[model samples]
Structure formats: C-alpha cells, structure tokens
Target: MPTLLTVDIGGTNCRFARFSIEKGALTLAGTARRQTADIPDTQALMDACAEALIAPGEADALVIGMAGPIAGQRRARLTNAPLELDLSDAETRYGVGACLLVNDFLAEACACLTPIGAGAFPVLGPRDAATGDGTIGIIGAGTGLGTASLVRDSRGAWLPLPAEGGHAAFPFTGKEEADFQAFAASALGLSYLRGDDVLTGRGLCLLHAFLTGERREAAEVAAQGLSRETETLRWYARFYGRACRDWALSTLCTGGLFITGGIARRNPLVMRCASFRESFYDSPQRSLLERLPVRRYADEASGLWGSAWLAARLIGALPA
Candidate 1:
C-alpha cells in the first residue's frame, strides 16, 4: 500500500502520521510528533516527518492540517509560523505529485463522520434542529479555539464548513464583557474582544491570571488540581462555562455541540462543574437551549482520520 503522509500542526505541537488506503479504508501505520518550539523551520519539520516514516519516497501525497488560514489552490502559508510553506515545492523535495492543506479542526470534524470512542456529554440547545437538515457544531478549546460545522445537505451527506470563528469578537454575555475587558486591559494590553482570548487554552490562563493574581499556563491550572476554593479557579471555571455557552448559542447546535481539544477534554472539573451547565442554559432562550445534546470529541486520532479522508477524496480514490 502506498503511504500518505499526514501532518497535524498547531501552535504548540506537530503530530505526523502515516496512513495507507486499504480496501476502501484508511489504516494507520507509523506515527510521530514533535513540539513546534523545538523545530527551527518548515524544512526541518518536514525532514523530521520524512525521517520518522523512514521511507522518504514512499508517500503518494502529503496532507497538512495547519493552524493558519489556507487560501487558493496551489500555495499556502502559515499564519503563525515565522516561515512560509509552499506546497508546490513538494514536487521537487519529495517527488510527490500532490499536496493538500486543510484546517486542523475541520479534519477532526470530518473524522467524526466515522465512529469514535466515548464522548463527554454536553448540554445542547435547540433552535432549528430537525431531521435531515440540522447542522452539527464543533467548538474545541485547545492551544487555541477552533470552530467548525457539519451541515447535512439535501442529499443527506455531512458537508464540512470551515471558518475562522475563533477570530470573531468574543460576544460578552452580561458581566462577561466587563470581566473579560478588565482582564484584557490588564494583560493583553487591549480591551477589544477576541474569541480566542476567551475560548482557548491561553484564554483560560488569562482568566486564571486575572482571578488568581498569578500568571500560569491554563493547562497547568487544570492539571495541578489547584485549590478550587481559590477565587481565581472559581472565576476561571465560570468564564470557561460562559465561553462554551456563548458558542452553543451562536451555533444553536441542536444537532449537538461537540467540545474537543486538549484543554477541554483534560479538565474534568470544567465539564463537571454545575456552573458550566448553568451558564450554558443561562441565555434568555433557556427553554430552547435546554434541548440540545452536547458531547466532547473523545477520539484523539479524530484529526488524523480527517486528514486521511480528505486525502482519499482529493486523490479520487474514494467516492464523494
């Protein structure tokens, strides 16, 4: 089986996997990942991936799931990477004929079309949820925030819609704007709203810093089992809940709201907190919001599956 090299890159880490199409299904072979800060440039990263696979010329195509925006058909660059990645260059470097760029979260959502492991049940809201036409929403809080939608078309196929929802202004709900504004003014040096500033891992840290008066990574706060009685931790939980609620309202994810990413899934306290549900249903349309089912993307390989699926489609190896 010819290999397909897949890379899932985020602000913090880079995950690489090798997949081969087998009898109409994607089978994983070898996988490796590295931290972004450790790598110096794009070439080095790609080289590391090639080395991990141990077969430089075996892959038929390369699929990159990047944290940045992808545009046009032939070339793309990373929004956060200091260096630019030209996909067409691969024709010479790897002798590969094709390259594909896709949003990392979109890949994860597409992977959800397949069966995954258990999920963290979420509190979903109702709006236009009906048979055959309702939309599915994915809100992931990881190194950063990621939002995507799966809309069921008339033909009944789940179509993926990718967008920069994380960059959207963080809509303040009641005192949320006030609290967020204060945090931003004091830390970020700007009071304007940013969805990532509140919905991401760093956002959680920012909230912790404001309430706890200590600067630390959000993942650390949740991992260390910090004193829940501390006002800072309490405030962080409240804000986290509020952020999830806000996305739920915007999407009206009656089909269901999926919360994924490292920060969200690792923090069981955040999910179990009563405030999380309360804030989720705190909207004026609580009755409508109460009916939506919510869950977390439990499968870590979900993103890898997405990349492989897209690769199969682009190569015309699978029916659309």
Candidate 2:
C-alpha cells in the first residue's frame, strides 16, 4: 500500500489530504487547508502541499483539482487565483514523478462517487431512486457556477466527463426572467445572463438587487437571513431556485444533484424559501425534471476526497 497526496486548489482555499491504500481500502491520514491568495508562487504552493502530506513515502506523485481549465497535460488557467501553474513545474518542485491536473468541478464530482451515508449527505428521495445508473451530475456555486458530469463504467467506478457547461449562455424563460436580464444588461453590461452570473453567491445578491432595487452583498443578506426581509432577498431566493431547476433539467441528473461550493451551503434560507420544485418541474415536457432528486453536500471537504480518489486512479492503485 502506498500513500498518495491529493490537493484541491480553489479560488479561496487550497486543501490537501493524504490517503493510503491498505488491504484494498483507502484510509485518510490527515488533511489541511490554507488560503490560496497567501501563497505567492507555484513554489510556495508546492511547499504548502509538501507540508500538508503526513505519511512517510518517497513522494510518488500528486493529483490536483484546480479552479480553472487545464490545457493539455499541463498548465492551468486559474479563475480566482492569480497564478497559473504547469504540471511539470509542480512535479519538479514537489519531487514527484507525475501529476494529474483536472478542473475543480470535475474533481468535486469524482469525490462524490464514494458512498457517503445518508446522514453525512442529505437525501431528497429514496436511495433506490438514483436510477441505478453510473451517471451523476454536479453543481457548485462559488466564485462562479461550476458543473461536471460523471459516468460510471461497468466496473462501477466513476469517470469524470470534461465540460464547460458553466460558460453556456443562460436561457430566459419567463417575463420576470426577461426583466431581470434587461436590468443586468443595463447595469453590468452583460448581453445575456451567464450560468455563472446568476448561480453564484454574488449572483444571489444580483438577483436580490434586481428584485428589490436594494443592493447588498451576498454574505450580508445570507447572514441577515429573513430577519431583515426586503423584496430583494425574496426575489434572490426565487431566481436562485429557478436557476438551479434549469441546470438540473439541462443536465438530466439521474444519480442526484450534488450541490457543493460555499454559496450553496451558506444560503439555506434562500434554498428553503425558493420555489425550487416548481421552477425545476416547469419544463415543457416534465418527465425527467419533475422526478429529479436534488441533494446537498453539507461537508465542503468532498473535493479533497475526490482528489485523493483521482490520485489512486491515476497511480493504477484504484480502478477508474
């Protein structure tokens, strides 16, 4: 059994965990999280990664899920962080022979493949309701809207499908949606809503403002909850729900809607209040969207777990 170092680099936080394969079971050694902006360069990030790995090994390799698109086998265009890193640079700095770099959202979806109990993860329907297929859809709202699809092969192992679904233009369906888009176009110079624009935490604030004319940060509105109700927060909930519903329908997520990311977790008030089901089932033909199971991952560390799993798969220790 060999130990692997797994890293998940987000715009806000970078988390690393060590896992070792012991008699066919992957065991967690330890995990650590550090801020991304605090590190100046790739070298500093590698140093942080080195410190995060706990077990004693010769440092076989590293697998990282970065926040931006990865070009070829190396190089990443990070969305939030200023630094763009090459995989070869990371391998040289960490003294590892190989490295795997994947988009952050895809990594999160891979992480969710592990069988987490119903208690650890909130379920929207029966466990048997997941369609018994290897297919899964993931949605995350952080600095941006993140999405990825997962397909399990005959071996029941998860494989991440690369997608730029977030960059897709948002489709406006209702009168309110048209009105909201008009406001955004005049205010933000956006011709049309992007999936990232309305699905993110800041997007919530944007929705709140469009609905109420009062502009406030997403954090403040979430912190205030319904204590200080304004027309804005109410609209924010509705818009957010509708956006989620649309995404679910577009993805046809039979496995489940695994909602991770900072914004989705913190804005419980909005999720509960929003007409999520109504908007979700509002499709013209509703056989799929009406029955889609939506669930939220309360634990934010699932990405790191997925990164570890990715490392094992890349190393040939675990089946893909």
Candidate 3:
C-alpha cells in the first residue's frame, strides 16, 4: 500500500493525517492538529505534524489543502492567516517524492468522493437521493466563506474546481435587509457588502448588534439559536439559505450540494430554522433546487480526509 501525508491548513489550526491503502480502500492511519500561530514556519508546520503522525521519510507523497488561491499549484499565501507555502522544496525538504497544493474547498470536493457517503454527514434537506455522479457543489462558512465544486466529466471522474465566489457581492432582499446591508458595508468600510462579511461569524455579530443594539460576540449570538424566538439566527439563516440557493443555481448541481463549516455545525439551529428553509426554496427556479440534494459534513477533519484522498492519487500524477 502506498503511504502519504495530507494536511488541511485553516486560518486557525492545521490538521495533518497519514493515509494508506488497505484492501484497496484509502485509510487514515494517524492524525494531528497544530495551531498556525504556534508553528514558526511552513517547514516547522510540516515537521511537527508529520513527526506526530509518522516516522521520518516513511511517506511517499505530501498533499496540502489550505485556505488560499494556489498559484501554479506550487505556492500560496493564506488569505485569512499569516502562513505562506512554497512547495518547490517539498521533495528535498520533506523527503517526499510527490507533493501537491490545493485550495481547501478543492480538498472538500475530494472528500465528496470517498469520505462522504451513507450516514456520513447530515442531510439538511427533506430528500437525499444523491448518487454523486453529476456536478457537485460545496460551500461553507468559517473564518471566511468558501466555495468549490466537483464536476463529473464524460469519463465519469470528478474534478475539483476552485472558486473565490465568497468574495462576490451578497444579496439582500427587502428594504429592511437592504438597510442592514448598507450598515454592514459602512461598518466594514467597504463600498459593497460581500458574502465574506455577510454569512460568517462577523456577520452574526453585526446582525445581532443591528437588531438588539447590544453588541456581542458571534458565540453569544449563536447561543440564542434560530428558533422562532431568536431573530439574529433567523436572519442569519435567511442570508445563508440565499447563498446556498444562488450557488445551486450557478453550478446547476445535479449530484448534490454539500455544506461544510463551523458556523452551521456549531449552531445547527440555523440550518433547521423555517426561515432558512423558506429562503432556500423561495427562488423562481425552486423546482431545480427541489430536485437537488443538500447535505452537511459536520466533521471538521473532512479537509484532512480529502487531502489524503488527493495524496493517494499523487503518485500516478508524478512523472515516470
């Protein structure tokens, strides 16, 4: 069985997992997590996590999936954190023969292949007939909004496509919501409100403050929940549903739409709220959305598993 190391780097913490094939199935051998702030550099980040999971030079390849746009698939600077990676020295520095760098959401897309399956993640919608052979959409909200897709080709292989759709303009409906959007834009000192600021933790804080006038952290607002009682989470759910609907429309995701992120996992009430369901199915093209499946990968380590999946295939991509 080929062995490799896979990493999932986020704005706060980095997750490392070692993978091996057992009876033709990819298996996670060991895993570890380290804070980005604690690791001194990229080398240290790799060394510490690798040491935690495996012995030196035991890996055949290395794969990294993190929060950043990859340039030439060899280098990147994380958008939400101070970490930067240069994979040119990966073979010599990490003692791995094959290496790859990719967007975190791409890794999420990879996870859709083997890691997600029957009862693997929660189906947030009423129906789930996802055979996962069509174009799949993946989106999430954490330190920032993340979006990606796994499009199935005529050859029936799912290819991960990265996108920065999170930075695009956020939609606000009605005069009340539009006023809040203006307020958010003004508060953040931006000309237009973007999804990065609308559907995340900061968005929760801003929404709470606008309604209650008593500013509190996102954690506080989340504790109130998205039930009929809590206005903050209801509005947040509305914004979130809009994001899902728009993404589904754009991608025309017939396979399935998977949601991954801390916000929903930490506050599942938002996903269960009536407002969320209403807004999600409120579009003119609601029939298209109704046919699509919606699921949630609640495990935070999904990216790590996804990275391992890619690392397993890295050997085939290496030059003969």
Candidate 4:
C-alpha cells in the first residue's frame, strides 16, 4: 500500500488527512483540522499539520492544496491569510519521500475525476445539460473565490489548469452597482477590488451591511433564510452568477460548470434563486451560456480528498 499525508489550506481552516491506496481505491486512515487563525508560527503549524496526519517518516508522499497561487510549484502564501509556506525542504526535513503543492482549486478539479467525484456533487441545472465531455470549468466561493479547469489531453488523460482568476478585477456596472462599489472600496480600503474579495463570504457580509445598514457575520447572513426581497442574497447570487459566467466563457467549457464551496453547497438556495439564473444568462451570448450545464460540488471535505487523490497519482499509486 502507498501511504500519503495530505493538507488542504483555506483562508479559515486547515484540513489534514492520512490516506492509503490499494487496488486504486482510496481509504481514509484519519483526518484532523486546525483553524488558520490559530497558527502561532509557520514552522509549528506545519509540524502540527504533518503530525496530525501521520508520524514523521511514515508518509511516502506529502501533498498540499493551498488557497493561493503556487510559486515554482512548491512555494505559496495564502491570499487572505498571513501564513507563507516554502516547502523546498519537505522531502528531507519533513521526512516525506516527496512533496507536491498545487493551487487548491486545481485539487478541487481533480476530485471530480475520481469515483467519489462522480457520486459526490449534484447537478443544479438541466439534467440533460452536462454530457460529461469536453473541457470542464470549476469555480467556488468561500472565504475567497477559487477557479480552475479540467481538460482532456491527446491521450484522453484529464489535465488540470490552475488559475488566479479570482484576483482579476470584478466589474460593476450601472448606478446602483457603482454606489455599492464605492461603498465597498471605502469599507475595504481598496480602490481596485478583486473578484476574490467581492464574490466571497466576506463579500456577502458586505452586501448585507449595504442592504440593511447593519453589519453581520457571513455565517449569520447565510443562516438567516431571508426572503428574496432582502436584496442581500439577491445581489450575492448575482455576483456569484457573474463570476460563473465569466469563467465558463473564458474556459469555453462544453462539459459544464462545477460549482463548489461553503456558500452554494451548504446553502443551495443561492443557486436556485432567480437572481442567479438571470445574471448568469444575462450575457450578450445568452444562448451559449444557457447551453452550458451546471453542477455544484457538495462535499465539505472535497479539497482534502482532492489532495489525496492527486498525491496518489503523483506517487505512481494511481493512473495519471
């Protein structure tokens, strides 16, 4: 059996898992978590993540999926968090035979390639829409917006394309939107707002504040089953749809769009809301947008599983 230690680092929390593969099937040995805010130091936090999954020298491979752009494949710092990781010495210092690092959404894309992927997410649009062919686009919003795409190669092998699309500027048109943009700019102290900042859980809080003139946490807003008239959820849904629309068009996805994250997955009402459909289909190329099937990855531990799956592949335990 091939043993692996995997880590999924997001803005809010860190998930650690120990996986063993046999006969190409993944078995979860154990799992653990630590809040990102609780990380007192970089070295200590890394050690804690490693030991939580497996003892030193026990893991054949260590794989990590992080919520930021990967640098030279093994170096990255979280976009919304303060932790910076340089895993250049992991193979020796961490006692793992190898270390693999990738953008968190790239791991999310790879998860949809596995059997668990097939049984995990539910389609949100027309059942007949997704043919499960051609290129697939993945986007999700939680603490931050994450994006990636999966494409088939000449060998028919699926290859993952990672992106920093979330960091790109998000557009706001019309007077109402312009007003909110100005307010957000003032609130966030950023003249130029990125998609990651505006289409995220934090963004939902901002929307709530703008609508009600009251500040609330993201969880509070998500939990309150407020009506459509509230406008907070309506605008959030609209922004999410816009993000999805841009990614689908940029990737030119024929397979369909896979949406995942704590936002739409935990509270599916956002995807079903009329505002989402309207904004998504509002593009000048409306027909093209309508043709794209949509699905949402629902598993909360999706990134952890994705990291383990990619780890197995990187270590030659599973087919690439």
Question: What clash count does candidate 3 reach?
Answer: 0
Q: 61-87, model 2: which lDDT tens digit per residue?
A: 577788888898577867766977776
Q: Which segments of candidate 2 are over 4 A away from where they belong?
A: 54-58, 115-120, 123-131, 153-157, 226-234
- Candidate 3 residue lDDT tens string, 1-320: 78878888888778888888777677878888888777656778667765678742578878889788999888988888788888777777767678899999999877877656444465455464755577888889988899999886677666788998899999888999989988888998999988889988888888888988878877767776443458787788889999998998888888888888888777777778888888989989988788888888877778877777787767763111
Off by over 4 Å in 3: 120-128, 225-228, 317-320
Error of 1 at 16 (Å): 0.7
Best by lDDT: 4
Q: List candidate 1 stretches off by more than 4 Å.
A: 54-57, 73-83, 117-133, 153-155, 174-180, 225-234
Model 4: lDDT to the true structure = 0.81
Better of 1 and 4 by TM-score: 4
Q: How far is candidate 2 from the true structure (C-alpha RMSD, Å)?
A: 2.9
Question: Can you give the lDDT of residue 89 in candidate 2?
Answer: 60
- The C-alpha TM-scores of every prediction are 0.84, 0.87, 0.93, 0.93
Ranking by TM-score: 3, 4, 2, 1
* Candidate that beats the other on lDDT, 1 or 4, i.e. the better one: 4
Clashing pairs in 3: none
